[model samples]
Each structure stands twice: as structure tokens, then as C-alpha cells.
Target: MYVPKNFQEPDRDTLFQFVRDNSFALLVTTGDDGIPVATHLPIELLPGPDGKFQLVGHLAKANPQWKLLGRDTPALAVFSGAHSYISSSWYDHVNVPTWNYLSVHVTGRTNLLTADETLAFLRQQVDKYEVHSKHPVSVESMTEDYVRKEMRGIVAFTMEIDSMQGAAKLSQNRDDKNYQNIIAELRQKDDTDANEIATEMAARRVDNGQ
Candidate 1:
């Protein structure tokens, strides 16, 4: 993630919130052959017993991704949120079209979870996702035998994030006139991505004491 200084998102609170909201992220690792392998996974963010934040996610047992990359290897988790195209016509000055987006990159070491941890991870994920559900389910919803059988079908892993890099390319580099123009143009559209960028831009304006 090559974030320009002008586009770098420095708000630590916003960065973690973005990860939680867009928890379905891409996990990337280099294979033994040095080819990059990637998996699209939904991760649950949790505080470990040791007090460090941990990423909890599972892959299919037959996938072999964990066997190849889950142990003692560097990994990257990419959380991509909203993005949209900014037309040059929306700028006050002559400029080419560009994309505005928000994303977070996490680099860490991955470790396969033990059987006990896998079960615990599943319960936590269900609890987290079903917090608002009327008919919330839990690990106790299934019989012990059934839960064990199901656990055999998946592989769970945890990544303790060592570093996080973030970016939000939201036209902060533009002049006031151009910035307002971009926001107005975005707000005029029905596209969610554009609308999201517009909202962020408006918040940024307030942050800048505009």
C-alpha cells in the first residue's frame, strides 16, 4: 500500500473500525515456490487472553492453504472498503480522472489454532455476528458429537497483527473549489461507493476546520 503523505489516513480509531466493518478480507502469503497465494476470508477481530489483538478465521480443511502458509510465515490481510472513480470534470482545474478509496493492510505471522482454540473461535464468531439477531445461535445449539464432526471439516488460524498500514485517497490533495466540486458530484449520484466517498470528504472538510 503506497500511501502518499497527503492521502495517508492517520486516524487510528477509524482504521480499526474499518477493519471490523469490512472484516471479509484477503489473506495473502508466499508459497514454497515463492508464488503468492491468496484466500478471501471473513476474520473476527478479538483481544487475546494475552491482551494482544488477534485475527480469527478459518479455512476449509481440504484447502491446504494452512499447511502451505499458516505456520511461521509472514502474511498480509487486506481490508478494502468503499471506492469510486472521480471524474476530472468534477475538479476545478485540469486533472485526469482518479480513484478515491479506503483500505487497510495488516502484516503478521499466522499460526494454526489448536482444536480447543478452533472451537472457541467458532463460538466467538457466531456470537459476534449474531449479536443483533432475534434467533441467535450458539455452540450449544448443536450436539457435542455434531460440533466435533463439523470442526473436523475446517482449519482455524490466528494472526497477531504486527503492523498496520492504511490509506484513504479522498481528494485531500485538491484545492477547496475542486474538493467541493468532487463532493457535490459524488453526492448527486446513487452509487453507494461514490456516496460513501462523498460522506468521508464532507467529514474531512469539517476536520480541516473548513
Candidate 2:
């Protein structure tokens, strides 16, 4: 992530919130052939007391990507938030089309979790995603035997995040007038993704006291 000073997201809380809001992430690791393999999975982001980040997720045991973890291999988890294409028309003809989005890249050491630990991880993920649902589901409701059997089909792992890099490119470099125009154009669109980017840009402006 090549984040310029203006676009750099240095707030730890903000980055964590972004990860939680966009839990579905791309997990990448180098395979034995030295090729990069990626898996899309829903992950749980846990923040440590020391300001480090931890990620937990599971992939199908049959997926060869799981074999890349452990040892000296490094993993990257990429979380992406609302993104949309910005038209040049929104920029007073001075700008070219570009993407407005938010993303966080987490690099860390990967470790496979023990069976017992994996079970706990699955339970926590269930609770996190379902806690706010209108019809919440509990892992405990399932029989212990069934849960164990289900866990066997997947490989659970944890990443002790060594570093996090965040980039929020929302026309921050544009003049206030141009930025306002872009926001107005985005907000008028029917697409939810465009609206989301507009909202983030608005919130970021407010945060910067602009």
C-alpha cells in the first residue's frame, strides 16, 4: 500500500473498525512452488492490548492454500471497503477517472491453530457475525459431535500481525470545491457502492476538521 501522507490512515481504531466493517478479506500466501495463492474468507479481526492486530479465519482443508502457512512463510490479509469509480466529469474536467476506496493490508506470521483452538475460533466468529442479527444463531445449539465433525473439514489459522498499512483514497488531494462536487455526484447515484464512498469521504472530511 503506497499511501501518501495525505491519504495515510494512521489511526489504529479507525483501521480496526474498517477491518470489522469489511470482514471478508483476501488471504495471500506463497505456495511451495513460490507462487502466490489467495483465498477469500470471512475473517475476525481481534485487536491486542499492545496495539497489534490478530486475524483468525478458516479455509477448506482440501484447499492447497492452507499448506502455505507455518514455517518462515509470511501472509498478507487484505480488507477492502466501499469502492467506486469516480468520473472525470465530477472533477471539473481537470481530473481523470479514478477509484475512491479504503483498504488495509496486514502482514504477519501465520500459524495453524490446534483443533481445540480452532473450535473456539469458529465459535467466536459465529458469535461476532450473528450477535447483531435479527435471528441470531448459536454454535452451542448444534450437537458437540456435529460441531467437531464440521471443524474437521476446515483448517483454522491465526496471524499475529506484524504491521498494518492503510490507504484511503477519497479525492483527498483535490481542492475543496472539486471534492464537494464529487461527493454530490456520488450521493445522487443509485448505486450503494457509490453512496458508501461518498459517506466515507464526508466522514473523513469532518474528522480532519476541513
Candidate 3:
């Protein structure tokens, strides 16, 4: 979350889109013992009562991390996008190897959701993920009693977003020649992350009208 000025992404729309694209995020909170606990889950971005954005997700009730919620302290949600290793050899000038990536961090106060609210969230979640399936299943397809029984095993909560920050470290600091070379090198790799980074870098260049 320590974003350099040059790498900082201040656009709210861009950050929100990133969160939606990379909905599976890391949720972090500090317990009463002052130790940090984390959970990896699919978090949805929604507007809260205050008309500001918030994060919604559920955790297994047995997970101790859920106990850390609804506290005075805030929780952090980290949405990570594509990343790749950038070798120094890709640059003409002497430079250390680094990573090129995109990520967004959101922090906020969280509160437990009512059972009805949680049910609604679950239904929406199911629909969103099943949209691409050939025979998409939905919570509505299941009996209400069955769904309610399953909900008993988990805790749902919403974090009203207080702040959001993003970092886009796509070799923007490098010279034009080095930047182009890095993208080319990344694209040559068969790795998914590498190809994604290359595409993001190329897209950013076009966005900046470079």
C-alpha cells in the first residue's frame, strides 16, 4: 500500500473497476490480541447507506478471523491483479530486477449483516459467478430451507469504504526504449501473468497517449 507518487492511481473509477474485475481479495484485520488475521474470499463492491462504496463478503463462522470484525479498528481488502517479474537485463541502463503489477487496497469499518441481508448477498453472488456456466445454477434454483441451513455455517459482513488506494507499477519509471523492451520481453513468455503485464503496460501507454 506504500504507493510512490509516480505509481499512484488516483482515479476512483479505475480503482473500482479493478476491484470488480479482481473480486477475490485478501481481507485483513487485527484481533484483540493485536495479531493480524487474514481471509481470502470473493468480496463484492456495493454502495452503502451513506452512498459511499463498501465491500461485502462472507467467512466461515468457524474461522477466527470473523471474530475480529465489527471493531473500532478498520479492515483492509486487497485486490491484486496481474503481475510479472521484470528483469534488469531488459533495460539498457543498469537497474535491479523488479515486479510490474496492479493492485488496489481499501480500508473501512465493518459490520455484520443481518440474516436476510446475507441471504440476498449470497443469491447475488451465486448469480454473478454462474453467469458464464453452460447450465448456470442459482440460489433460487435451490430450496429456501436448504440455503438458510447452509448460511448458518458462515458469517457475512459489509465494510463501508473509508479509503481506497491503488498502485500500477508497469515500468512507467523506465525510459521509452526500456519500457517497450520490457513489454516485448514479457509478451514472449508463455506465462499468463507475463502476458497480462505486457498487455496492461501497452494499454497504459495508449491511455497516456504516449
Clashing residue pairs found in predicted model 3: none
Against the true structure, candidate 2 reaches a TM-score of 0.93
Q: How many residue pairs clash in each candidate?
A: 0, 0, 0
Candidate with better TM-score, 2 vs 3: 3
How many clashing residue pairs are found in candidate 1?
0
Per-residue CA lDDT of model 1 for 50-115, tens digit only, reads 997878899998876777656677799999999999999886667799999999998899888898
Across residues 59-148, which tens digit of lDDT does each residue of candidate 3 receive? 999998998899889999999999999999998988799998999999999999999999999998999999999999888788778899
Q: What is the lDDT for 63 in model 3? A: 97
- In order, the Cα lDDT scores of the candidates are 0.87, 0.87, 0.93
Looking at model 1, residue 166 earns an lDDT score of: 91
Best by lDDT: 3
On lDDT, the stronger of 1 and 3 is 3
| Cα lDDT tens digits for candidate 2, 1-210 | 788888898888888888899999999998778889999999888754466678889999999888888758779999999899999987776657988888999998888999988888778888887889998887787866789998888999888978899999999999888988889999999999999999989887888798
RMSD of each: 1.4, 1.8, 0.9
lDDT for residue 109 in candidate 3, whole number 0-100: 95
